[model samples]
Target: MEDRLNRIESKIALSEDLLEELNLMVFRQQQQIDRLQQQIVDLHRQLASGSPGERRDLREEIPPHY
Candidate 1:
């Protein structure tokens, strides 16, 4: 009976540790998601505002070797 109780206690401890690790992993992922979301929002604002300077000809973008 004592041996069975020890095994159960050990399993519980391991489960608690795994739960903590999983929670931390989820928190880090959420932080990354938040940063990506903010970047997307900033990009949208920049596009809506348009280019800051004079427009260039598309031909100018071609490589000289072409």
Candidate 2:
């Protein structure tokens, strides 16, 4: 029947719209994840290099004989 065909068409359109929205959301999330991963990698590299700004001293005391 024509009515059934129209209903099916409407459902298909709605499904397509939902799929498109979901795809965009996934793409945005992926971009955010990539950015975070890159930041982590850069931080790791900086830590591994032992940059002067990241150095710390934990000496307890100095001897008086020096």
Candidate 3:
């Protein structure tokens, strides 16, 4: 019947819309993850290089009572 066909078409349209929204969300999440990964790499490089005025032998500061 025509009524049944109309209902099926409406359902299909809704499903397509939902799929598009889900794809957009996934793309945004992937962008954020990429940005965070880059930030972590930059932090690792900074720590490895050490900062100005930093002492390399600070490990010798352990108290005699230890």
Highest-scoring model, TM-score: 1
Sort the predicted structures by lDDT, highest score first: 1, 3, 2
Q: Give the per-residue Cα lDDT of candidate 2 at 47.
A: 81
lDDT of 3 by residue, 1-66 (tens): 999999999999999999999999999999999999999998888778885347758787898899
CA lDDT of every candidate: 0.92, 0.90, 0.92
Q: Write the per-residue lDDT of candidate 1 for residues 1-66, one digit (tens) a residue.
A: 999999999999999999999999999999999999999998888778885457789877988777
* Order of candidate numbers by TM-score, starting with the best: 1, 2, 3
- Candidate 2 residue spans exceeding 4 A from truth: 52-54, 57-66
Worst 10 residues of 3 by lDDT: 51-60
Off by over 4 Å in 3: 52-66
lDDT of 2 by residue, 1-66 (tens): 999999999999999999999999999999999999999999999888887385446474566775
Worst 10 residues of 2 by lDDT: 52-61
How many clashes (backbone N, Cα, C below 3 Å) per candidate?
0, 0, 0
